[model samples]
Target chain A: MRELLRVSAPVDLGAIDPRSTPGLPEATAGEHRKGWAREQVALLGAGLGRRQEMLYATAKAAQERPGPADRPAGRVLLVLQAMDCGGKDGTIKRVAGAMNPLGLHIRSFGPPTPEELRHDFLWRVRRALPPPGYVGIFNRSHYEDVLVARVASLVPEAVWRARYDEINDFERELTDAGVTLVKVLLHISYAEQGARLLERLDDPRKHWKYNPSDIDARARWDDYQAAYAEALSRCATDAAPWFVVPADRKWYRDWAVAHLLKETFDTLALGYPAANFDLGRERERLRAGEAGAGGTGEMNGR
Target chain B: MRELLRVSAPVDLGAIDPRSTPGLPEATAGEHRKGWAREQVALLGAGLGRRQEMLYATAKAAQERPGPADRPAGRVLLVLQAMDCGGKDGTIKRVAGAMNPLGLHIRSFGPPTPEELRHDFLWRVRRALPPPGYVGIFNRSHYEDVLVARVASLVPEAVWRARYDEINDFERELTDAGVTLVKVLLHISYAEQGARLLERLDDPRKHWKYNPSDIDARARWDDYQAAYAEALSRCATDAAPWFVVPADRKWYRDWAVAHLLKETFDTLALGYPAANFDLGRERERLRAGEAGAGGTGEMNGR
Candidate 1:
């Protein structure tokens, strides 16, 4: 499934079919695949809870280790990128939403604040990075500098093109600091995206989710696609690879994400910290109470 | 119940009975007080969940308010202090633990690092404060500068004495900025703490919780009680009044904390962010999704 879905090398995204559902259940004749895909997502969700708990515990105990350091405890960051209404928010709700908030953080990148713009593009991103022993989900992440900025001519061609190497180096630095990078590009066809954008306009409850900029970008779809293809090809490395997901079916998008997360956790090889206190002396003292206490404070009495 | 627990003005440390369960149910002769208190805690927990959710939503919408600014959205910070085995950790697990992690963060303070020691005592504390819309729980807080620094002779009498006004002014700044501060000192009896420390030795799983410094602090029970009495007296104000929680029994402690939180939320006058988007345009857009929606990329000059 991973081999079929992952883009280890550069490929023309235009050749990929967005509506085609592969690496998931085969569509039976006259069958509702949403129900089946939803069931799979549920099953994956159940397993995710237990695995996430262990991962959190492992992360907490990593600093005070009396345990194996084979796979050092740290953070896993999942970066999500796609066209507007590409189900980044939906993916967050269905998959990342199941996570423990204590260790799971979602950072949605919007336009840069004045303070953020005062520094390099990565400055705000650096601040939002998850602390050790947690997972961070980035919705419409740092890639926008290349994707939107290049397509709209917000920056010159040379500058946006040069960001590919910078992003790769930045990711490698994170990997060096015990971080796992899961970069995903939710691939949707041109026609499917137009439908999703129009659907947003029609649903009043979802008006908050709609942005006017979406249509302007949609007007330059080919440029954005080319930018994404270039970014995915250049930035996807041995340490951090890109997953090009077929996202016309929201359920399949969620299921594949959960599957990828499960695979990531499995590789972490997490375990609970070992207990490191004397059992016998502790028992004897418990029964004795303060009769066996008062050694230190007495020495430095007020 | 709140009047009984809160310290609106200066109060005596020695006069207050730690064993007295005045604000909670009395464990009368053959009375199932534990079961009753547990039931009450559960009820409060359920209400806490709902109120907290509203607070979170209200906070998120505060910045985009077409709503009243009279009760603007903000953050809540709970500062917990007590001698060893006074149940700061237990209080966090049972109380703040119930709130959504999306907006609830707990910071456990230990000895200052070299960099921290170089800054003002409030520097690190200010940094760990909950971001707007969050509930930040401090297991041990900056009040330690006055309490431990005074009782242990770590600083001159004048240095610790001067910190009282500093803390008051700092808290006043936070209150002005819309943060609600709930400061609590979990007051446990000397004998009860000795018993808890001893019991920790008996349980293997609890060994990780037992620190050697706990016993040292326990020996200075009288001194710490005096330090706490003074700190509470000097710092308690309208914006951030101090609550002395009787922590002999863990259930009662958790219940009182939750009760106080419910009171805080009730006073917040929190309302959901009002719907302010264009409903008519949204409905029209939704209807259009099934109609004219498939022209881009090829239609564009791309």
Candidate 2:
């Protein structure tokens, strides 16, 4: 049996330098691997753009043939987390925005309800898990209990520490159950965040989305950064590693997210199930006053 | 001022004939008009499919490009009514499924929350309207308090009767604010509804969607039909005419909805705004340690 204790650990936030990270191996690890990482990112970016165009085309085709069982099954789940102005909504609008509705599902989880707060943190999250052949996304997920709550002193340090392990276990369970989780942490600098917040306040229409409390949150920016570093360090398991994306530039953010989502879906091995419709057999069955009496298996054909 | 007392007599449920009557026009309307209606239906079917494809594409493109002002500022609102098996969800998925997330917002209202119940019915609805450059879809919206509640004797007769005028005025407000409302009623046969309900019961995964209370409502199906006819007849205004779609066949349902959505978006004439980039000016600005921002205006140069 797999050892659960060994799998979970508290994330070490303070020690990680964004410059020196797991993505680029140490000098002793060899230049080949480093070159490979860069190549992978480049190749993933190209495949993602191609897949995006194909996805739009496929959705258009599906519109013509409204209900077809032959649609590609299996989907991608993209998880995004960020500080107040982190581009979660913008990310969704671009990457998965054009996905075929039948194949892709985007779910946003705000603050949990009273009933949800009573259960284990993961309960509400598990309920939103996509069914087979669908992609489900969580905007700000169970991670909030550990990251934001801990940083803001909303929860005790011990309570937040205990959750890193819980998150690891939960993610492992999802991966084992055929769900690919791409966790993205949009890392915008304090200066960039200030510009974004000002933009929101400056615009009258966006006033609805701004909260006065966000200012208080901004004051504790360093604490949140420390929390993110810790959570990412601990939870970046082999199964679902976190990507610290530099998000100062909106163009780069789009490119990075598109790369991440494209990579996740490309690995899902989704395709139409293999089956044959024997027209002759269908015609013969129809002739015997059994036109609509095809077995339940026929239902699955669609 | 519009005449408030000019309401047509309510449709008599007992007089409904599936073979004729409301399914087709009265004899007084003439054969040439009938032929025209048939041709429009066919053209609408084909045009709808094409338009649905374009809507998704346009929305996706808009979402990808970030405006300098950060607001494209346009929207489409699609509304429908309530019934256990009402085709709202299906219609939304089929018609507006692949729309760009940036340009699409779908709001589904349940029995109102305490906050919503306190206000007029349109309060919750208007709050849920899409921002500029987006499409807002309402699944079983504000009309419920009027249509179903009126038919089921759930509300006072006077209160429900007043709603017809209220809805027309409310839709006019949306249209004036640059929001286009496309309303559709999926007219299904009693037998078809029975088949769908049975399918839901037989499928374990769909069991949550099955409510025992639906059977009680289905039993009073004729009353619901009469309520729908009465509601549609009154509120089908020139600004936003109600389309009574023959929805026994899902294929035709998709076709009709696609046509309606396509026509609306096509009318908007949306495309990329002009590229106001001055390469020479930008070159000077770059050398002067400043980037001259692209001011917002008629970006029609594209």
Per-model TM-score versus the true fold: 0.75, 0.50
DockQ of 2: 0.08
On the 0 to 100 scale, the lDDT of residue B299 in model 2 is 13
Q: Candidate 2 i-RMS (Å)?
A: 15.3
Which residue runs of candidate 2 sit more than 4 Å off their true CA positions?
A: A1-77, A81-182, A185-241, A244-302, B1-73, B275-302
Query: Candidate 1 docking category?
Result: incorrect
Instruction: List model 1 lDDT by residue over A150-171, tens digit each.
Output: 8878778888888888889999
**Chain B superposition TM-score per model:** 0.89, 0.71
RMSD for each model, in Å, please?
A: 6.2, 13.9
Find the candidate with the highest TM-score and give its number.
1
- Weakest 10 consecutive residues of candidate 2 chain A by summed lDDT: A1-10
- Residue pairs in clash, model 1: A202-B285, A202-B286, A286-B198
The candidate that achieves the highest lDDT relative to the unseen native structure: 1
Query: Per-residue lDDT tens digits of candidate 2, residues B1-302?
Result: 01211123443323332223232334535546545544545465445433433444444445445566333445677776635665766766546544444345677777787888788878998888866555677777777877667777866899889989998999888787667777766666665555666665555434434555566676566577768778878887878766655565565455556656666767777553332333344334332321112233211110
Residue B270 error for model 1, in Å? 2.3
